[model samples]
Target: MISTRLASLLFCSLVLLACSSKPNQDYDTGYDFSQLHTFSGITTASNSDPLSAQRIADAIQSSLLTQGFKQADDTAQFKVNYTFNITDKPKKSGLSIGLGTGNWGSSGGVGIGTSVGVPIGNDSAKLQTIQIDMIDIKTQQLIWRGSDNFSFDTGGEDKAQLTQQTVAKILAQFPPQESLK
Candidate 1:
């Protein structure tokens, strides 16, 4: 029984990991991340909506602050910019039907078979992508970037929670590990 429970737990862990989006991170290897202590984020008007943009901006600030980074004014050392996009994802659910006819095992006997698949649940969904970029104010150049893509059912998800979760996932790797350099 214990082994069965353990196996079930392991399976659940793997499934959750597989479902979560892993951010694609890129950074300037030559830049020293330790010297940067303050940040300000720019949320473009192009973000899906004003409320979502605010949620993302707030999430980024909260994450940075939790990481011991301070928010600054226009003179901040590094500035953050993000873009959020949501588009209608094509429906992958539909009806499938198949029919087959052939001679049966019996002599001169005819056989027929048919199968139909009717998909259920909501077919409308959206694909969302959030891209975060960190730029050096002095050089006006990108120093770090992370982005991830995820999808959600159009009707069920809480937009704020989803935005927070997505932003956190992307920024969790900020200030790229030194060992990676």
Candidate 2:
């Protein structure tokens, strides 16, 4: 009987896991530039997750290279940098209700409460924003900038996959207008 119960529980767990949805890919990659050449190295502002920062930077660099931008040496046609910020908010799990009368009739009552499972205070880690900027190396003026704000669950393997996908999607917006069909 115990084994049967355990098997049932395991089946339910796997079903729930399978039913869970993957993170939605939401990003905006709007740029005004028509054409561009080799891109220089990328720089990142101080980030809580240095590994994440590097991963993002590398992903963008690789995407740029695939787009025909040669990694430059002495000078770059454009320079890039990114900033990431994370925020947390408390989450509530259940609801609360008051029940009248205790066993002693001492005017005391039993209060039942349950959490809503929704963030109530700064409790859940959320990726607030990911901002990337590109500048004209010669003029040192801002050429392109993109910022995306989205919520994500952290410290999971899915987070890393999402990051890579987000970076790639964002960089895909570079060089702006696409070739006419």
Candidate 3:
């Protein structure tokens, strides 16, 4: 009865916690993003998952093309870099307290297994950060950046589609709108 309700509430809370955070964008305020024409090299973070990274890169390139940008052969105006970071954040489970008087002595201890962290997909939930940076070729400096934070499972289904969709969401903040910068 009461335990069932508590379990349901906990499950709902975990789902909410694993929800996606909106994409964020930042750029050098002094930089004029509109002046940029073509870009190249969406090099990914070292040791990042290759297949997933490819999906992300393709989506980003497609999005940039749609934004009226082109791929360059050499000395492109800007260089793009991307990275995916995943961290295992252990959930803080609750401990139950018990107090009573026993025949031998006073019995008081914390009961274990009072709470358990909810799982995501087929495995544990993880905190995921996806970042994309745009660097000025001539200056060799970062001019614009976009990122997104979310909780998800590494073993999720349709991983390719997930990567594509996430890339779309992150790149939607790209080019650093003038007013936003």
Candidate 4:
């Protein structure tokens, strides 16, 4: 029975891990995260498409507001900002060749092998990196940063949805944990 319970727990753990994405995050240990409560509009966004930039900013604003943060332009505690970059992933060769020579039982043998990797999904997808930053307005220093990458297609019909999801995913790590301070 214990073995069965352990197996069940392991299955559940793997399922949870597969469903969640952990963003790359960093923060300044000297900053007190608990005191942060207000933010202004996105200080700056680097994106070729103004519409997409606006969508990202709005998504960030909505996420922060939902997390109990208020918008304060003049007396803001931290400034919210983000950047978007799209990079073409280098094409990968699907075929691989290998050769090996071995001696066993005082006999030598030569072996050659080749393997092909057939992509089951789109291999030409471009990756976009979205980085969100929380900067101290007075010090002009970055206190926290979170970044993540997702497959992006310029002409995709779900650009708005993808932009919002990417921003939310990256900003989900904002404010840092009090333990980090």
Candidate 5:
């Protein structure tokens, strides 16, 4: 019973340790513009899974259009592309200890206490980052971009919902609205 409790605790600790840290946003402030117009022929950085890339790109484009941007197929103002990079890091397990106390009595009477030691196990997981970039078609300089990090889970029916959430987050910085003075 003690060993089973220890194993459960260890498993929970390792699961918490595998979560990835958040990524920071790096944007260029010099190119601040009130309105952004889309460019023709929006392209994607080569991805291992073209179908997945298309799904993500389509979602992103839809979000941008809803935000009042026009999509161009010819010469346009801005070009969009997305890239993803995955990395794995090692994680160490967590250890915990418990203590118990007991008492002894004379006249052949005695009391006992219990203690437990939890030994956690080490594990590894990949940290996936999706970077969406918007570039000025004329100058070829990156005007705006957002990178987000997520821990990948293979089996989930919420992928489409999650993708929509990610798209909304990334485009929240777009249009570059200025503060009222």
Candidate 6:
């Protein structure tokens, strides 16, 4: 019985973790990304989850380094920045718990218990819109921009993995492929 309850909870958690990766990209076609090497972070994000934003920046830096880019303390060849907003969404689900009890009194009594959660004001989920930008150090203007809109249970499992995957997805559109243009 406990196993069944645990399984149900796991399934619900997985359902809540579904992320829709809606990505939108804009960049300066005139600027050549191949000429850029060093990368530094400059952020103006004031979201509730500053740590998530920091994780995102770290993931981005890691991804760029893997692609042969260098990290600079200052005066980088290019700069990276990001902003995020978490919007409260309407509740799509309710919590449920079940309890059962029986008394051995000549087949006398049985009891059942259940609980359901009701959404209060501003007690729904959160949807985050994240935007990542790249700027030329010399030009000091926007050179590339990538944004993604995704939703997941902020308190659920695998948060670090989620952030890493989200950042990786956003950066996959960066450096703007010639075929994409």
Alpha-carbon RMSD, each predicted model:
9.5, 12.5, 10.0, 8.9, 9.9, 9.4
Candidate that beats the other on lDDT, 4 or 6, i.e. the better one: 4
Enumerate clash totals for all models, in the order shown. 0, 21, 0, 0, 0, 0
Q: Using Cα atoms with residue i matched to residue i, what is each candidate's TM-score against the true structure?
A: 0.71, 0.58, 0.65, 0.70, 0.61, 0.65
For model 3, residues 154-179, the per-residue Cα lDDT tens digits are 54455556666677788777776664
lDDT of 1 by residue, 110-146 (tens): 2334455444676567887889999998998999999
Candidate order (lDDT): 4, 1, 6, 3, 2, 5
- The TM-score between candidate 2 and the true structure equals 0.58
Clashing residue pairs in candidate 5, if any?
Answer: none
For TM-score, candidate 2 versus 3, the one ahead is 3
Full-model lDDT for every candidate: 0.77, 0.64, 0.72, 0.77, 0.64, 0.73
Q: lDDT for model 1, on a 0 to 1 scale?
A: 0.77
**Ordering by TM-score:** 1, 4, 6, 3, 5, 2
Model 2 segments more than 4 A misplaced: 1-35, 89-123, 178-181
Model 3 misplaced regions, further than 4 Å: 1-20, 89-123, 154-157, 179-181
In model 3, residue pairs whose N, Cα or C atoms come closer than 3 Å (at least 3 residues apart or on different chains), thus clashing, are none
Give the alpha carbon lDDT tens digit for every residue of 1-181 in model 4.
Answer: 4554565567657867976767799999888888888998784556696776777788889889988999999899999888877788744557876555556796666566889877656666677777888998889899999988766656445877877787787777777766345
As for lDDT, the candidate ahead, 2 or 4, is 4
* TM-score, cand. 3: 0.65
Superposed Cα deviation of residue 156, candidate 6 (Å): 6.3
In model 6, the worst 10-residue window by lDDT is: 101-110
